[model samples]
Target: MTRTKLLAKIRQVFPGHDPEDVQRVLDEYAGPERLRVHLAILKLCDEDRRDSPRHYVDSACQDHRDVLAWAESPQQLRPDWFSLSVTERAKVAKADRQQYARWLAR
Candidate 1:
């Protein structure tokens, strides 16, 4: 399935989940470790309590934050960013970049 459809499904599963938080969870949880459990919980949440994380952006995700921060820093961007999901990575990229910059400076 496409990222858009996946994100939409996730949103439906957790209406209160911050979109950025969903993205972060997606990035981090796409692993063999918690993959099954997370997906199951997500499904269970859909059936029972569909709750989403509040702060989705990874403060320590320098790479992801860097991508976004650089994009809007000099107001430059990679063409690939446009090709990616407009809502998730791109939006967080902007915020993460800003937040990341400060976090890194210290």
Candidate 2:
């Protein structure tokens, strides 16, 4: 998504948060080969931990292993999971498969 649309989505998902902080979190966490911003936010929401996007982004960046493990098992699977685009879902699913393959290879 474009920066403008991303900003709008973040504002919609995390109302009352400072836009500056949201942008910073986006810049730090969201990337093509890294965390998908929408996925992170959806995961956070599924875990009922939507305190702020910054908190999620910080933990995801600094303690990615734990964050990824958390993503593997949400407290409850939310319908919002369907909100992800087909490409995003496929990418994450493929990543999961690769991760599991590596784990199995170990």
**Full-model lDDT for every candidate:** 0.46, 0.56
lDDT measured at residue 6 in model 1 versus the true structure, 0 to 100: 51
Q: What TM-score against the true fold does each predicted structure earn?
A: 0.36, 0.44
Q: How close to the true structure is residue 93 of candidate 2, measured as C-alpha lDDT?
A: 68
TM-score of 2: 0.44
Candidate 2 pairs with clashing backbones = none
The alpha-carbon deviation from the true structure for residue 63 of candidate 2, after best TM-score superposition, in angstroms, is 5.5
Tell me the spans in candidate 2 whose CA falls farther than 4 Å from its real position. Answer: 30-35, 42-49, 63-106
User: What is the alpha-carbon lDDT for the whole of candidate 1?
Assistant: 0.46
Worst 10 residues of 2 by lDDT: 69-78
Task: Report the C-alpha lDDT of model 1 over 5-97, residue by residue, as the tens digit.
Answer: 456656767777675677667566443323322333344344445364222223223233332333234232555655667675666567756
Taking the tens digit of each residue's C-alpha lDDT, what string does model 2 give over 37-100?
4445535543474756666667766765555555553322345658888887777667766653
True-structure Cα RMSD, model 2: 11.8
lDDT of 1 at 30: 43
